[model samples]
Target: MMTTALSPEHSGDETPKVKDYSPTSYITHSNFEFCGYSLKIARTLSASLGVSAYVWEAGIALCRYFEKEKISFAGKKVIELGSGTGIVGILAALLGGNVTITDKPTILEQIKNNVSTNIPPACRHRLKVRPLTWGQDHTNFPTDYDFILGSDIVYSLVSQPSLIETLRHLSNQGATIYLSSEFRTGNGSLPFHEVLLPDYFNCQVVDRLMGKDITVYKMTKISTDPADGL
Candidate 1:
């Protein structure tokens, strides 16, 4: 079945866990040179199947968009839905956006642990974490956000509908959603989103060469509202 949101049960338990670590001792990617900063990929994705520990491509573009476009995340409310490893969401809060870094409760602890480790202390004052699953409806949210971000979130066809629906529901009027993805030749899951996105959004792809094995695409949400516009 096609879905666009996830139930809070996806977050697992409410056990609050937070720990700190040093990247110097961790086995992570050596360098991700983009957006004027070097992001580390850390590990090949162990969270789910087929997904590798590849660093976020379009995410790097979104970071560049923040810096080059002089995008102000400072004091703005932000959410990173389906944030895997949450590099971009952490970046948003670090840069001054009042950020909510959410994922399945399953990964929520990992998100917090990563936040403690990754956020450069200089900007750590502005970020927080939450449990959010797309496609599963809920009434909990800040009610409005100046920006909502997702990066490389598509991995299944069912997720596309949930993602689109979640984006529509969570977005405020005139709010902007910055999503990024790369075209995969025949992953069965790659092109799934391309067709579905146009239904609820005027999607645009921003392309650029990132590395030897990556091409990034950014999808901007042009217009939408809750209730699926359905």
Candidate 2:
């Protein structure tokens, strides 16, 4: 049934199925179960694509959060940013949200493959994939998306401005942004909380034991309007 510990049996012993043409390739498959639904995800290993080719812990945590919150995606319009391995978006699709899962143009095929493999044909109509480079023109994308989902996307300082801008551009007033990032010890981690976040969205640090390193934040767009009576 449902188990946090992964078993080799869960990874299906079938011969590695070819999904693409990468000169040298390595692949792994895993299963995740939540709310009585199971999803099979395949990951392709690539030196160039780096971590974008695999599912990260933050993604798993977000899935767990969705299950815990009893989030029903039925009829909801959702967008997932940097949807590596497409785990979270697939989970959303299974829950019934009409979801757009996006990443760099180079990464879209892998995500598409994942979506094709895991999501059933009936539920597949609800999922879409697109190339989205944050902080750029997203005029073609929906601005009134009911929910924006991101996981482990706050790792870079260079991208923070565009990230925030993209967030503002995608979210309509009062829409919630759910972002999960691990609390890294060094590098640009602290800036997200200490520096960059204060300048953009109003953030609430979720106080649950998501291990010591991982923290999930619920963010809402901060008003830019001058005070009526503040």
Candidate 3:
């Protein structure tokens, strides 16, 4: 799978290129094959919408890892955060997970469209789209998920703390979390890995796509009480 980026600043049919990445302005849709099903994702481009309308490399990489490892989401209760195009969460549903796909309220419609396009009528009941703005709307969800998924969500340092907080809130002791991120200089990803996340969860790098500079992490919550150590 090829990686794509969005340059939301430019407009009017002229595609602005970002380094080795292609801007999503000219690309209205993307296609992918996962779990033996072909997925056609519709994309919208606007200076205001930014990254939420496009599928990032990290999201695709995570989907590839799932198929490669034959990861089982069968019968699992799953939720995906920052579900931009809803690709990752949609795949989880296809793998038999009862899934909730979420992003900011503005992006929820796009995700809902993708879910409807890809998931068949029979499996439609297995997935739902909801609005989730990290730390703010986490209470609306229950802490009983079997797995939590995210991709390319840790772009801003300002949002990392809240994202970590939401992750902690949504996961129970038995829940597992999976996050995939692209490596970029000066991005919040480093601090998230080194500082914020370690305080709340035990994380391990379960997969790496070295060529793409993306890594997928598996995390489980750490006990909050000091007494647990004793």
Candidate 4:
């Protein structure tokens, strides 16, 4: 729809470290196959107000949702946590279900455009894009969601705890939380996620391959968290 776009593969993040709000471009791939129907969706960044967002690798990740349709999504109110490109969780919504997308304040607008571009005109009403900073007040988040998701978000020591905290705060009484991440060494390269999450939610590891060495961990959160015994 828009001419602005990013690369399918990031050679390097040229995004400047600016504190002001503006539009930026994000690019990700979305490949969908239905019987003989194959479609590739490309997402571009659209910034307005102060939010910056883009659609990500929805086509590839959508395969995961198809594989794990039972747990990934189905008749659920879904919220995507730390949506870098917002592709992974947005596809879940496009498939059918209520979807809310969240990201840092800096990326708010990008999340909006990505979500908007992917949905049909009618289904556009079903999606919600909001600003969500980890460990911060989530004023508009519903009390419960059938599923919560995060993708490629745990890349720093500064963000892990806040992400988990946001996960816990938004998760409802028996909700399942799914976090997809690639392992990268950062200051948070300690026993961080291993220890903190168990305190509030039971974590289930769903392993998946991300290209090669990069692993996308499909972490599930249980309602009955038994941390004392662990």
Candidate 5:
């Protein structure tokens, strides 16, 4: 949300100069209720911060899915990828999951702040915010996660391969992965699940929000047989 503030110079030539603006000046907060708790989330309107700074509809859809389905993450090792605003992961922690909320290095600070705003001091130990850049940082995390969550993360075809690789790296055979995305034309999100994912994981549509163009997919790693094609 970087806006250019132009101030006219007093010189003979009427020229405008740029005024510096603080990034925090563009931040706004929103409150959402989940698990009987009111969570306040801060979002930066700066486009430079990228789409991760705003809360997408898909994220809220996933949150509702969690409540409607009564999916239990209690005592589970959970991680959320591309956790913009950390809403989904925060809700999971409130529901009793030991959760890790992650995004790229530049966005980690925002997620950390959101985690602090929502999670109470005593229960804050259940949540952690860390930097993770898809394929590059996948190795730093363990592969034994019980649940992996993502929302609105599959908009880029260019990043699909790395995203899939990271998902594979973080999940074991027993792990379940939930991803919610808005279906946009030429976004590669639907194809990521229908085409790209079947090779490494078994995926199915677990929920869809009518009229919202958002879908929630539940996936699990497919155990391979070395001799299957031999």
Candidate 6:
């Protein structure tokens, strides 16, 4: 429960930019404890698979937010996009949600390993890892999710469009969406705002206590058309 303001000079990015590492071999560990539940998870700390394998500050901020708000995930269907290291999704499953943590195909096994390693046997059935390439159609993925979670996903402008589209496709009507990102970055939040505007999602900045200047956005899909039934 520390409120460290993030600066560009010291963003606390744990994963060093390595030229290359075998995705199957280079492993790193991340641990979390929330609401009387504790977990230790691991990931392949290499960017070789087009995925990050370390815990980001934005993600830690999210875990803190959930802890502070006492957000309950019991019986809720949730999907976490860009679930790097799968910490947040694992936490949700621990809170009683049927959660799916997703990333690119290359890093799925690592994510699965993290889930298998962290989730308890009783809750293991609720946590799953799926391969998801942002900006692509997710018709094959689960829909009607009650909540959608993403952390530090807005850094890349090129991927924002596809990310927005995928969110639109997967989100159920009136679903609550939470997105967290670092403050004072070059990307800021322009791309997310511009894309989400046409989609009619009511977005707000919820002030939460977190390390650095990580901004957590609370979004809810507004049903503008009555014909769009659940």
Tens digit of per-residue lDDT, candidate 5, span 77-101: 9999999788899999999999999
Q: Scored by Cα lDDT, where does model 6 land? A: 0.73
Better of 2 and 6 by lDDT: 2
TM-score of 5: 0.86
3 against 4, candidate with superior TM-score: 3
Can you give the lDDT of residue 8 in candidate 1?
Answer: 19
* Residue pairs with clashing backbones, model 3: none
Worst 10 residues of 3 by lDDT: 5-14
Model 1 per-residue lDDT tens digits across residues 28-102: 332333334444324323444123233345555566656655566777888888775667787676677888887
For residues 98-147, what per-residue lDDT tens digits would candidate 2 score against the true structure? Answer: 99999988888888988998888988889999999996756668798888
- Give the C-alpha miss distance for residue 17 in model 6, angstroms: 18
lDDT of 6 at 75: 93
- Candidate 3 lDDT by residue in tens digits, 24-91: 34335555677686787766665546888677778877888898888989999999999987889999
lDDT of 4 by residue, 1-230 (tens): 11122333421133323334345643544444422223334434344422223333332443354444444354678887767556655677766768888776776655565565666789877788787777776655776788777655565777777766677678766676665544546635234545766677666555554453223343445646467348
Which of candidates 2 and 3 is the stronger one according to TM-score?
Answer: 3
Lowest lDDT 10-mer window, candidate 5? 3-12
TM accuracy, model 2: 0.86
Q: Any residue pairs clashing in model 2, and if so which?
A: none
Better by lDDT, candidate 4 or 1: 1
Error of 4 at 105 (Å): 3.1
Pairwise lDDT winner, candidates 2 and 3: 3
In model 3, which regions exceed 4 Å deviation? 1-27, 225-230
Query: Which wins on TM-score, candidate 2 or candidate 6?
Result: 2
What is the alpha-carbon lDDT of model 5 when measured against the actual structure? Answer: 0.81
